[model samples]
Target: MTSVPHVPVVVVGGGQAGLSTSYWLKSRGIEHLVFERRTAAHVWETTRWDTFCLVTPNWQCRLPGHPYDGPDPDGFMKKDEIVAYVKGFVAKVAPPIREGVSVERAFRRGDGVFEVKTSEGDVTCDEIVVATGGYSDPIIPRMAERLPEMIVQMHSEQYRRPEALPEGAVLVVGSGQSGAQIAEDLHLAGRKVHLAVGPAPRCARFYRGRDVVTWLADMGYYEMTVDSHPLREGVRDNTNHYVTGRDGGRDIDLRRFAREGMELYGVLDDFRDGELRFRPNLAESLDFADRTYNGINAAIDKHIAQAGVEAPPPSVYEPVWRPDAERTALPLDGSGISAIVWCIGFTPNFRWLDAPVFNGAGRPAHRRGITECRGVSFIGLPWLNTWGSGRFGAVGDDAEHVVSTIAARLEGAAPAIQAAE
Candidate 1:
């Protein structure tokens, strides 16, 4: 039998979250190893489309000890630029990351240490950090399986460009940021596009003279904790915004797309016998999105007035709508819709972990980054403690917190081990 090498910590996944944790662990003088199934920052390098850009601004790319201090902080980073940025950070920090090493299994041993079985070998660690990020597996609805085989179906992750898709009208399911952006991409490429609008909050790229994100940061919105937030449950489970980073950031809502000659449909309900069905609440969903946008602007305006701060003139966006056919159901045969792209977001994957640290939904069950399982921690989960916990700008803070907890636990265990010896 091969003797398992022991380390103080083992961090799985080498994306932003794992790298951040590695940095903190090194700073605290903790002996650790980081295992990445692919190259470091693999998702940003391969998963994103060619024209994809960071939805958040460049300034929010805050990793531990490496903040974005470039000339265009407000500008969004493209896919290549983002990959380069992560690479630069990794070079600077030089985390002990074993790339292309897949972690097959990770479970606690009888001796209380974690045995992480990997392609290389098994590693025993006192603690384990799962920083695989929130977006794990692409979530496609069951209705997708019912779609006709003739329709070229794909998840947003597999979509590379508009020209690459089958030549016909494209039906994009789920009107979150990816759905809205992909619909717009196809429309610009001269393809007839139909967007299934979901209820997602919309916000103008710029409010007053500052970026919407900047205003939110100024208002301490990002600092709001789950316990103290007014709409804690909603904020925790809210979908992505109907906005895009292309062309210097802009709002991409159902109304805007409708005015731009894209057919808007309500939530996708079912598909049967080559006919797709949708709910008959397209207008109501658009109205709800608008109200949410307006309420956010109203709150920003109120803050400016109460703070007595001089700001730029308010920018008003008039909602535009074009009357179209009531498309509750459409036959896929001759509708010119050749492709269906599902952008319904992602779900976390923890199948490799044989620990009882997951909730009913298979998400890591933890308050902040500390789980019920001792010495097991999770970072890069949405609403782990605050609104920004999973975001690039705020993941470093969560990583630091988890590292501190791990350090304390290790310190306590050292004395006990000495006593046992």
Candidate 2:
């Protein structure tokens, strides 16, 4: 049997979360190894489409020791710019990162140490940090299988550009940021676009000559926790804003798409014989989105009033609805919709970790990234501590907290191990 190399700590991802954790560990002079399945910032380099740009402004790119200080702080970064930024960070920090090495499985040993089996070899570590982020696996509806084989389907992660898809109308099933952006991309590419709307929140890109994110930060909205927000449950569980970074940051809502000749439908309910059924609540969903959008601006206005900050007049966006156009059922062949883009969302998969670290709902059981099981921690989970916990600008905060906890635990006596009789 080959001997397994042991280390004090092992991080099992190479994205922003993992990199941030590694930066903190290195700062403390802690010995650790980062096993990345691919190269650093693999998601940004590969998963995102060619025209993709970050929804968050550049000023919010707050990796530790690498805050954005460029001339265009308010400008949104494109995909290549983000990849280069992370690459620059890696070059500067030079952490102990092993690219192209994937951790296959991780489990606790009888001696209270973790055995992390990787493609290259096995590693025994005193502590393990999982930084795979919130978006791990692309979530597609089960009914997707029922669609006719003639219809080509792809997830938003796999979608690159309109030319990459078949020559036909596209049905984008989800009104989140990705779906809205992709739909707009397709429309610009001269493809007929049909968008199925959902209960995604929307906000204007800029209000009163300031980016929406700037306003959000000024109002301390990003600092709000899941437990403190009025829509606590939804903030923790729902998809992000249905806005876009395209056109230099602008609102991309169902109304805009509908007015632009893009077909809008309700939630994709089910699939029948050569046809797809949609919910009849298109009007209701649009109303809800508009209310949520206005509510955000209203909060910002109230904050400005209380703080007595000088700001321009707030912009009002009226709702746009055309109930007669929304169809409940459309045959796949008749609509010329040869492709379906499933932008439903992503779900994290931790099956590789053979530990009881998950809750009843199969989510990682952690409070601010600290698990009940000693020496195990999680980072990059949405709403882990606050609204920005999972974002690039705020992931370092969570990483710092987790690293400090790990450092404190490592200073004490060895972890307790239950011996079998």
Candidate 3:
């Protein structure tokens, strides 16, 4: 008779979150294995554009024991730098990882142990930490199919460089972080750019005398959890503030692009009859973004006053440009747009993990990584614990919490193990 392999814990990813969990589990003397179907840098190397950089400063690269050690802690890490950082964490952790081993399915078995089916072989484990970060599948709109066959269309993930695009104006849909940054990339490259703006907010690169992130960190913003948030779980669906770390880290002011030669429109409504349709919400969306920007600044201003901090004289942004007329439509033939980049974002897919832990919207239903099932948990999800949960900033905290929870459960079940023996 053949004996089946078993591990006390199984981590589904080998990224920073997964590696962080491994670090904590190792410290607790827990036996486990991490399954990663690809290298840690695969996503960074493949999906990100050439000029992509972390909008947050390098200081936020807090991967458990391996924090950012670069010379410029305040500066952002570019594509290569970010990849290097993740790889450095993997090297330092030296996690017991099975690379190239795909986790086909994971479910809590009838016996309480988890059966994690993988490309390698099935294994039973007491606990499974799903660290596969939220952004899984690119969300290109269904309207993309109606576009002219001659017009090149690609999701933001596939975009690399402006030179790689067809020669003509490029229409970038969705003005979240990716859209804004990509539009800036093309604009800087002297490409005729058309942007379809969304309600994604924006923040100044530097507010007062320091980075806005630093101010927020000082004000305990990073520590703010889901429970404490005003919007609570709804904040999870909020689009990221559009900013850029391309040059020396700057706010991606879409209005500024409008002031230049770039054309701006409202949210993309549809694509039909050889024309692209837009909702006449350009002015509203821009106002929404500015309000968020000013609102954040206002909070910082209040904090400065109460804390008795001397900083630069506070200032607010006035709209640099407004649409002369809301453009409702643009004919594709003369629009000069030959390529379309969809920067809407992605939805996390947990379909492979056939577990009842998911909510109605297909999101993992858990409080800060702990699921109702004793051994099934999630990590590396936005708002998993705090605003920084999905990023390197607070993944360690989530990882520690998950490992501790599992450890406590094991201790509680120890009597059963002895009884069975």
Candidate 4:
């Protein structure tokens, strides 16, 4: 039997969130062991793509005392730029990260510690933070199982570029950010792409001349406390933050794709023969449902009109939405579609974490990322706080809090995080 290594804290991922946590722990004079599935540079390098860019603007990519004080503050950071930024973060604050240690299982040892069993060996820690993000697993709906064996299919995670796709039409599912962008990309690549949009609120790729993130910050949207406001609750409950990227920018938003030969349908109903079917009357249903969203925009327009706030002409950033009643279907070979790409968003992965702290949703039931369960905590969750908890600008706050909690617990006091815990 191999002996399990022991440590003060064990962070189970080496991504942006995990690195941030480790960085803060090191700064606070905390001893930690970071078990990463891959090497430091290779992890970020694998996630990189030609068109990959952060939706969060450069200025917002701040982690603790370190912020992205690059040349371009307003613009988004490309994949290489982000990788370089993270590399700089690691170098400046050298955290003890162990690469190539893929965790196989994690369960509480009952002595206020966690026993993390990895492929290489095992380790024990006073605390564990599962920083692996939601996108680790790609989920294909059950309907996909019935599709014809000849049909080509791939999820957004597998798609690197338009050139990788087989030459033919495409069907993209899940109208969220990823789905919308992939559908738009395939269509732009001269492949007939049909998008199956679920019931979701549409957002402009940008508002005015500035990025939508700027407007969201200015309007107190990001600042809204998750506990106090219903809209904030809805934003947190329904979906993750939606900051549009270059792939779905104002010039080539989802609505433009609909106008440019990319058919937009409702939810995917079923697949039979060589045909893919969907709900009905997708267009008319969307029009009716959009009336509600139009009301909100009209209110904004009315305010602008009343305030005499003259703005530049509108860009191609029109709204995109789907009505609940609309159920349209489409045939696969009928549209000449050769592949199906699922761009649906991600969910957190907690499979290795076998602790009893998980809530009904399978997320660690920590109070603001601080574990109520002994010897366990969560970090890097989306929108963990109002000021910032999940974003690059916000991750440092959560990391600091988790570190403090660990310190306080060691001191035999209640885990009192000075900030964001």
lDDT of each: 0.84, 0.85, 0.89, 0.68
In candidate 4, residue 8 scores what lDDT? 79
Tens-digit lDDT track for model 2 on 228-341? Answer: 778864567876877777757887767766887899889999999877899988888888888888888888888888998888987667866566756899888789988999
Which of 1 and 4 is ahead in TM-score?
Answer: 1
At residue 212, candidate 4 shows an lDDT of 58
**For model 1, how does the per-residue alpha-carbon lDDT over 173-277 read when each residue is reduced to its tens digit?**
988888878888888788899888877777777888888888888888888887677775456688767777888887776676677778888888899877889
Error of 3 at 316 (Å): 1.6
Alpha-carbon shift of residue 392 in model 2 (angstroms): 1.2
Clash totals for all models, in order?
A: 0, 0, 0, 8
lDDT of 3 by residue, 1-421 (tens): 7666999999998888899999999999999999988876688888999999999999998889999998999999999998988888888888999989999998877888788899988999988999888988899888888888899999999999999999999999999999999999999999999999998899998999899999999999888888888998898888889887778788888898999988999999998887789999999999999999999999999999999999999998999999999998999988788999999999886778977798888788888888876788899998887998999898998899888888988778421111100
* Top lDDT prediction, candidate number: 3
Best-to-worst order by TM-score is 3, 2, 1, 4
Q: How many Å off is the CA of 121 in candidate 2?
A: 1.5
Model 1, residue 95: displacement in angstroms?
Answer: 1.4
How much lDDT does candidate 4 score?
0.68
Q: What's model 3's overall lDDT?
A: 0.89
Choose 1 or 3, whichever is better by TM-score: 3
